[model samples]
Target: MATMQSLAFSSPISSHRPHQQRSHTGLISSPWVICQSTHSSFNGQSLQLPQPRRVLLRGSSKLTGAITMMVKPVIQFIQGTDEQTVPDVRLTKSRDGTNGMAIFSFDEPSVFDSTGELGEITGFYMIDEEGVLSSVDVNAKFVNGKPARIEAKYIMRTPRDWDRFMRFMERYSDANGLQFVKK
Candidate 1:
């Protein structure tokens, strides 16, 4: 099994020397360019590329076949007395040590609405912003059979909870013959 630490996010192409000129086909034409020329151009310091960080319920798992599920940014909406309000908050998941416990963190408080009412969350939807839905629409395609029981607190907060949610999603996708493709 490949550990998550081994996965690195490498650039599609390596950085070229600043002095190197590009040809018509966008290929570097210089052969004697200084290797550190590009590094010096950026305030005389070489910028290191960011490494891929370990995210909960992400990356390819040999134990779970070759299918890799991506974790995208999601916004949670709360059901109010008469309307739904989108909070200025988002959901994020990270591994808690090597125990496989999914740790969910947020910048803002996890309160549902301004009234401080609990258990008012109706459903989970993939959204880019408050009112704007995600382009993929995972819910519309991946919801079938008996409705999955979703609690406000167990919204991708722990590994067990996340796994349950994922199983529901995978079941729907499998039944509908839909494959999740990474973009």
Candidate 2:
């Protein structure tokens, strides 16, 4: 029945500079930065190619009034299907300031010197806030069975905030059916 929350994907900044082909050309130098990633795959098709990293963490200065941003972005997640824990329970996508908006946290790591890309995370960045739709809380733990991935990306500066966060993740995945996990 088109499960996985009616399917929704693309936020790894559009799989290679794809914020509708971003290139606003202010000379590409604006400190309010974002984008962090880790990737690896097999059956999902990605022998290795999805490792993006960039974080300038826009400077925010405005205490108790209205706008208070704090971005600690770095994403890419895998390991799910558990009522409690196992497979590295994860989700961590952070961003603050520049008004781009981002905050999703759900990661579970008790002890993992390194291990990733087991299964679960296949997509990233889904936001909706008020109605309740925020699933991204970056993650990373290297050196395990030899394959687990997490890749993060964020881009917006007009395109109407990337079409208002892609229509609030497409109405939060068509009102919560949930699909948007990619390699």
Candidate 3:
């Protein structure tokens, strides 16, 4: 979700060294300037040094790009014969975006009371780009013998699975009127 542009300094500084070289003791010189040796600590000891080389200075480059990501969208859960969109749901994922948990909270106690009669929630489904995507291993939180919140965990174990998840998210976002935003 990012585009990068690279910019580098391209100019070369002139060395300006004389054709006839003059030798000095323990003197250091750069391409830009020459200075007299101030250190006399090397008492009468001659030092051999390498030839002066040209060095190019470069400017620090930045990414110069903007990264955008889609905010998690509200999801619709289908229970029994009823389908409803729950806005109080949250989708949290790992840093790699592979493993995640979807939590759906229901404020209406009647829905939980009615669904509890069956002893277990069955036919757990979600509306995806296609018709229905079955959700598995859904755990529920019960308060006073009535369900309050439900959590569904998902994992994408591979790149292909991640791609499929992205595709589903793309369509789901379109269906839910969601947009990607820069963080």
Candidate 4:
């Protein structure tokens, strides 16, 4: 079983740009700042940011450091009954970067160790600035596989709903023993 971990840190320079819209599918529209972290990680690899870049609200804002190198964001289960083959999952970020959609496949026999049309899992989540995750929706084909699907939707969010929706992802990640990598 592989253990999953979510890391969150405060940015030295947090500048918010208002009145801008992002061109992403799953992100919410709001005032967002470019997060330029000094130290970052992607899939357990250490990364460094180049410089502070102003993100345009009308398009997809790229995060510098470890995240820019990957083609897509993915969540992999490090420890689970299905640990033999880490489930292949994909993440779609929303325009504002606070919301996300997670997709899991049961179609690949070797990837999920399942045959036939076992269907797929789709999860929607909201992440606050405090790095808490709130489930907006979670759909699954099999009930026994709920944990895997739920965990895959985990990610960071803006602090828009921290008080009401505040829930630490680290606790959940630690409890489930899962690790996530942002590409």
Q: Per-residue CA lDDT of candidate 1, range 26-135, in tens?
A: 11222122233324221233434233333344357423212222232233434322222111112233435122221112222233223245454444443211122212
The runs of at least 3 residues in candidate 1 whose Cα sits more than 4 Å from the true structure, single-residue gaps closed, are: 1-92, 95-154
Per-residue error at 167 for model 1, in Å? Answer: 0.8
Q: Which stretches of candidate 3 lie over 4 Å from their true place?
A: 1-82, 87-119, 177-183
* lDDT of each candidate versus the true structure: 0.29, 0.32, 0.40, 0.32
* Total clashing pairs for each candidate: 0, 28, 0, 15
Q: At residue 132, what lDDT does model 1 achieve?
A: 23
lDDT of 3 by residue, 85-153 (tens): 332334444555444444434444233545545444564454432344456656667789966666554
Candidate 2 local lDDT, 1-183, one digit each (tens) = 211211124333212211222122211243343323222121122123233344434449532222223221112232221111112112222233222333332234321222333545544533223222224444443456532333234444443454445444533333323345632
Per-residue lDDT of model 4, residues 38-155, tens digit only: 2323222223434433444444764433212111111222111122222334544554545444443322222244322443422333232233233434333445653223233433
Q: Which candidate tops TM-score?
A: 3
Best by lDDT: 3
Pairs clashing within candidate 1? none
Q: Higher-lDDT candidate among 2 and 4?
A: 4
Question: Can you tell me which runs of candidate 4 are displaced by over 4 Å?
Answer: 1-38, 42-82, 107-183
How many clashes in candidate 4?
A: 15
Model 2, which residues run further than 4 Å from truth?
1-99, 107-155, 164-168, 177-183
